[model samples]
Target: MHDSIFIKSLFNTLYFVFIGTPFVIAFQLATALILNIEVKGINIFRTLYYLPYLVPMVASVIIWIIIFGHTGVVNQILGLVGLGPFDWIQNVHLIKPVIIAMGMWAAGSGILIFLAGLKGVPTHLYEVAKIDGAGPIKRFIHVTLPMITPTILFSVVMQSIAYFQMFTESYILNKGGPDYASTTYLVNTYNTAFRDFDFGLAMAQSWILFIIILIITLIVMRSSKSWVYYEAGNGR
Candidate 1:
């Protein structure tokens, strides 16, 4: 905690998690809801949504680089708007958001999980809710949401854990450059071990990370009782 670098990286990591995870979760769930509806050739739409996740990280980063790099596609558009270009990768203010956007690209798996959860929601519950005069939003709140709480819990915990260890997106993009603007705790820990060869500090960082993850996961699990509902009445 006394180490300035450690504190900064931890803050950046927390920033990434707190700022990015909820939007990603909501996006995944919303997309899943749309895709779950009975419609023509929905399988094709699912495949398209999942394709970005399947793309190799190197390829994905390269595409983003071309789009966000100085004088790249974004610059081209900005030029049209009478704004020449900003150094996206080198800008301290922008790189984190770019990395967060990269994180958003990997929401395909979460979407699939939510889709499965939606599918598992018993149709009879919706019928009962409709018979009770529940409108669409009320039916969703009263029937679909409660039934899917377990899935939401799973997604939330998993997303939080994943974001806590976020590295590659930052690492590949200039190795968390622009004066460490994008460096996360995991990235810093990695450099401490492999790049700087400070095994002692690296080990300490690892333990700290473990504690953080454990505490957050336990907190979420404990809090699940208020929101999550399981079929067997577990953690109700």
Candidate 2:
């Protein structure tokens, strides 16, 4: 039973990160780009965009719980579309997507980081790209993206580590329920140690999670050299 739970939790954790990180990064980058635009009241817009990140994680989770529960706002919206209520946190296939959706609540921090990276990109580089006959898309690909690669790398590594140990939201929202569909590594460790009273097993699980995060982080760092560029002429 322990082995089965452990293996299942590990696979679920991996699946969550792999499926969620891209969406998180994309949304963060898109927000950053939109906010980077020079406009009146931009700071207020940025603050509003970041308001969700300012909320405590537990509070955010609670809000999401209410939103995803039966007869909640989400269901009401679906009802408008002639789709009946759907159980979000309980359904096996839908649970991970719900968790992934929850991650978007805190994506404001990533937007801030991406915006900082966008700001650091020198204006002259954009001018040079334009002079070289680069269109908007070409300029973004050749200049904007390469310049922001470090920020992207940082975001990926941080998000991967966080998602690998995802606990609070899953614990509070799903309790790793619906047949353990949401049992991430950290949740499994918690249950093993506290609920099952298997300190040794839980300790082993913790170490395994650590090693997994370390290996994945190292892989990201190593692979970054091929894509991440530094104006200082160093690759990652």
Candidate 3:
């Protein structure tokens, strides 16, 4: 029974981490890139983007439940466009997209970090690239990307850690419903510990999560030397 439980939990955790981490990283990086652009009203846009992150997690989950609930505001908007109401939370096919959308609501923190990295990029590099007749695309590829690789790597590590332990959204919103379509590893651990009073199993599951995260972090650090850059004066 112990081995079976451990294996089940491990598979669930791995599945959630594999699927969700990339989405979070991609969305945050894209948002960061867009916000890094020099444009008017950027401050306002930044604040608006980050507001969701400031909200209490429980409250944010509640708000999303209302928005994604069947016959909720989202469906109402769709109805206005002559589309039928869709069961976002209940539909197995849409569960991943719904979770991705919910995750995106709090992408501001990642964007902020990326913006800091963007600002830290040496202006001299961009100037040199411009002198070499590099277009915006080329400049971004050669200068912006290489310079910000460290930031991107850091964000991936952080986001992967967080996503591996995802529970609150699944708990509050779907309760791992729709035939366990949204059952994440953390949720399983939570259920085992709290609902089932399986403390031993829960602890085992938690340790598994810790080991997985540690391995992933080590992998990121190992891969960092390939792409992550540091200034010449700064000792890496």
Candidate 4:
């Protein structure tokens, strides 16, 4: 029973990270790119985009609960499109995706880090690429992406770590419910320690989770040699 629960929680955590990390990174990078533009009032735009990140986690989850609730604005919008009064939190299949969507809502920190990376990329590189008849897409693929590889690696590692330990959303919104669909490793550990009063078992579970994260992160670091670039050279 314990092993089964452990494996299920582990799978849940990995599924959450695998599915959510891409969207989080994509949204953050897109926002960073947009904010990097030197439009008037750009600072205000940055602040507005970052507002959700500033909200407390419990509060933010509550807000999501309201927004994705049966009568929430999301369903209302869907109704206009002739769909959904869907129970986002209650549906077993949709629960994890809803949680992932919630994670993406607070992508401000990632955006800011990526925006810094974008700023640090040498303008001359883009100019040189343009001179070689590189269009915007090619310049982005060859110049911008390679230059920002470090940032991508950083975001991947950090976001993976964060998602692996995801707790607040499961605890608050789903209560690790709807058939334990949202029960991540941390949530399982929390229940083991607090609900079951099994400190030793919980500690064992935590150590296993730590080892799992360490292994995965090391793998990502090792794999970075193929892609992650530094100012000096490729990461090797």
lDDT by residue for model 4 over 1-236, one digit each (tens)? Answer: 76777778888899978888998899899889999999899999999888889999999999999999999989999999999889999998999888888878888889999999999999999989989999989988999998899999999999999999899998899888788888899999998999989999999989988998999999999999888888885353
Off by over 4 Å in 4: 233-236
Expressed as tens digits, the lDDT of each residue in 151-223 for candidate 1 is 9999999999998988888888878777788888999999899988999989999999999999999999999
Higher-lDDT candidate among 1 and 4? 4
Q: Residue 220 of model 4: what lDDT?
A: 94
Whole-model lDDT per candidate: 0.88, 0.91, 0.81, 0.90
Please give the distance, in angstroms, between residue 16's alpha carbon in candidate 4 and its true position after superposition: 1.3
Q: Worst 10-residue stretch by lDDT in candidate 1?
A: 1-10
Alpha-carbon runs more than 4 Å astray in model 3: 1-12, 233-236
lDDT of 1: 0.88
What residue pairs are clashing in model 3?
Answer: none
Give a tens-digit lDDT track for model 2, residues 1-236: 87898888888899878989998899899889999999999999999989999999899989998999998899999999999699997899998888898888689899999999999999999999999999999989989999999999999999999899789988998898788888899999999999999999889889988898999999999999898998898674
lDDT per residue (tens digit) for residues 62-106 in model 3: 898898888789999999999969999988778767877787788
Q: What is the TM-score of each candidate against the true structure?
A: 0.92, 0.97, 0.89, 0.96
- Which pairs of residues collide in candidate 1? none
